[model samples]
Target: MGTTFFTPNFQTSPVLQGPKTAYTKPKTREGQAMGNFLIDLSIGSFIHHLYSASNFFKEMVVLKSNEKCIMELSRWLHDRTGAYDWKHASTVVAELEDKRDQHQNIEMRLKSSIRQVLKCNFEQENITSPVELPLADCVVSGLLLDNICKNEDEYMKNLEKIIQLLKPGGQLLLFSSIDKSYMIVSGERFHSFKYSENFVKNAFDKLGLIIDYCAVQRRRSMNECNDYKAIMFTAAHKGE
Candidate 1:
């Protein structure tokens, strides 16, 4: 399973320093990034979205679900060792922004945009208790609920919890795993709920969120480390 992570396969290989072709840079909002405060939940491990977001958002709040994840992200913010190199990911983001030479500027903007990093528990009633968070103009989540949620019911509950953190008419950006039952991290096995595209759309629909964009990618490559067959990306906005 260890050897499966960085294999030649696109689905298994880490996008960090792997083949550029394997990395699929998602589309960002054109014209202007519209958000005063962007709240990101558990997207710390991958900072690709931050680069694109820094352009529009003045402030960013990172809600980490665990201490270790916060520590790893903090290492990168502090320029310490052991932090995963996200230069490649940011570079691709820069190109997408039509500023190929401004990758460093993008990084700087990202650092400036991030205002808060708090550790919270998703299982708790109030994800971030004691500290009241401001309603955000936008919210971004990366493979969070799928890993921790035991079933669709729990997933729905967590979705409502996350929505409460966003302002009315605010947007939600979700990066989810589709049809995945397990994932491997640091040689440890983690559980992931298997869900389909329809499942996700129905979840959001039930919450009254308007879906602006949605797609699911089924990777041709396979690996033994996890049972993920596809990845899902959704951009939706809350009703005013």
Candidate 2:
């Protein structure tokens, strides 16, 4: 069976919280130019990460592994009625960046920055087959490889595929769970590939990405849904 993309209903998890800091504090290599576009390949339907990024990139492209996810996210972006409330997330972002007065309008700015929503399959040999996309200045992926890859080899291959979407010296902002083997979504258990911090660093090194900044936050609260020991955030850039 092909890999399934599951959209968990729970929001405001620790994993979701990490991206707020990541987007605000991501460090890139000196002298590297941040190009015009940024692509988001994150799992789940949270736009909290994009709030800070929208100000940096001229255009943003969000990719979902399936059409169902694309349609759902597209609706969430364009339609405010009955959409997931992002006000709290936006408020946190505004406060973090000292733009507290603009918190109420952050969502509207994010929506305007989005250029398109496209379907993408990271497991496929060609992640963007049939539809050509421009190489992005930056790529953001959160909790995607662990959920989709069955093992370390598959994880590396998929990571390579994600990196291929970047131009030379492009930045990659990655958020992942460390040493997690599974996650429970809406009462259904799903597989999560287990790996360590060193494994991820080694993979990035092998892929020719220079790690500029990395931080790990140990899980402080007990949660029943997922067994992630810690959350890892890495900011890396490709070589020119």
Winning candidate number (TM-score): 1
lDDT (Cα, tens digit) per residue for candidate 1, span 1-240: 000000012234343443322455444344222558889885436666567667667799888987888898888887898977778877876776688899888888898889878887776778888789888888888888888799989999999999988888887888887889987766899888899889999999999989877766776677777887787778788888
Per-candidate TM-score against the hidden true structure: 0.85, 0.85
Tens-place lDDT per residue, model 2, 47-80, is: 7777777766769999888676787788788884
lDDT for position 93 in model 2: 69
Against the true structure, whose lDDT is highest?
Answer: 2
Q: Tell me the lDDT of model 1 at 119.
A: 84
In terms of TM-score, how similar is model 1 to the real structure?
0.85
Candidate 2: deviation at residue 211, Å?
1.1
How far is each candidate from the true structure, as Cα RMSD in Å?
7.1, 7.3
Give lDDT per model, in order: 0.75, 0.77
TM-score between candidate 2 and the true structure = 0.85
